[model samples]
Target: EAGVVQSPRYKIIEKKQPVAFWCNPISGHNTLYWYLQNLGQGPELLIRYENEEAVDDSQLPKDRFSAERLKGVDSTLKIQPAELGDSAVYLCASSLEGFSANEQFFGPGTRLTVL
Candidate 1:
C-alpha cells in the first residue's frame, strides 16, 4: 500500500567493494524502486520513484545511501564510502503504476561489500 512490495524472494550476494548498481527497466512502467537485502533477510525498500520523481524514500538511510532515477528510465543506488555493514544485495524493481504486487518486474541484484 505504501510502496511496491516485492515477494520474499532470495538474491545471491557475492562479495564486492564499494556500492553502486544500475538498472534499466522494461518500457511502460512508471514506477521504480530500490531495495536492499541482507544475508538471510528479505528485501527492504530503500526508495521509490514515480517517473523521475521520488515519491517514497522514507526507508532509505540518507546518511550513506542515495538513489536516483534519471529520465525515469535508469535507476541507480549508491553508498558513498560504503561500510562493511552495507554489504548486501541491491535490488531494482519497476511496476506499471504505483504499488501493485503483480505488475512489478525485478532485476537481478548486485551485491555490495566494503573491505
Candidate 2:
C-alpha cells in the first residue's frame, strides 16, 4: 500500500510563466485533495475530489489555476502565468473517504518558486 506520490519535488519559474504539478493517490483511496502553503502559513485546501468528481474547490483560484482528477486515481494541478505571489509549496493528499476521521496521507509536496 503505497502512500500518495507527487512529482517534481521542486520547481523554479519566472513570474508569468506556466507550471504544473502532479499527484498519484494511494491505491483504493477515493478522496483526493490539493493544498498550498506559504512559508509561514499552514496548508490551505485548494481543491478536493471525491473519486472523479470535484467536491470542493471554492478556495481554488480559477483565473490562473486549474485541476483535474482522472479516473479517480491520479490528479494534476496547473498554474498558468504564475505570479511571484504564487510561490509556495503545493501539496497533495489522499484518504479512503471524505470523512473527517479518515487520516489523510500527504506527499512530500512540490515546492514552487516564482521569481
Candidate 3:
C-alpha cells in the first residue's frame, strides 16, 4: 500500500502571499493528520481527521490556515497571507485509527520558506 504522498517538497514564498500544500494518505487508512514542525522542534498537531470528519483541529491557526479532507481521502492545507513565522515543515500523516499507536505514518513533508 502507498505510504503517503506530498508535493513540492520545498517552497519559497514571500510573506503575505498565500501558499497551499497537498497530501494523499495510505490506501484504506481512515485517520489523517496535519502537523507543523519547526527547526529543532517536534511535530505539532495542526489538525486531524477521521475519514471525512475533522476529529481535532484546535491547534490550527484559524486566522490564516485552513484545511480540508474532501471525500475522506486526499487533503489540502492552505495558509493565506503567510507570515515569516509560518516558515516550517508541514507534515501529513495517516493512521489506521485516530487512537492507534502503531498506525501513524508520516510523509516527507513540504518545507515552506517565507521571505
lDDT of 2 by residue, 40-114 (tens): 999999999999999999999999999999899999999998999999999999998755889999999999999
lDDT of 2 at 34: 98
* Best of the two (2, 3) by TM-score: 2
Q: Number of clashing residue pairs in every model?
A: 0, 0, 0
lDDT of candidate 1 over 1-115, digit per residue (tens) = 2333332233223334345677777677788888888989998988999999999899998987788888887777767756667767778888887475556777777766555
Q: Please give the RMSD to the true structure for each candidate, in Å.
A: 6.2, 0.8, 1.0
lDDT, candidate 3, equals 0.94
Clash count for candidate 2 is 0
Give all TM-scores, in the order shown: 0.79, 0.97, 0.96
- Which prediction has the highest lDDT against the true structure? 2
Candidate 2 ranges beyond 4 A from true positions: none
Model 3 regions more than 4 Å off? none
Where does candidate 2 clash, by residue pair? none
**What local lDDT score does residue 62 receive in model 3, on the 0 to 100 scale?**
95
Best prediction by TM-score: 2
Better of 1 and 3 by lDDT: 3
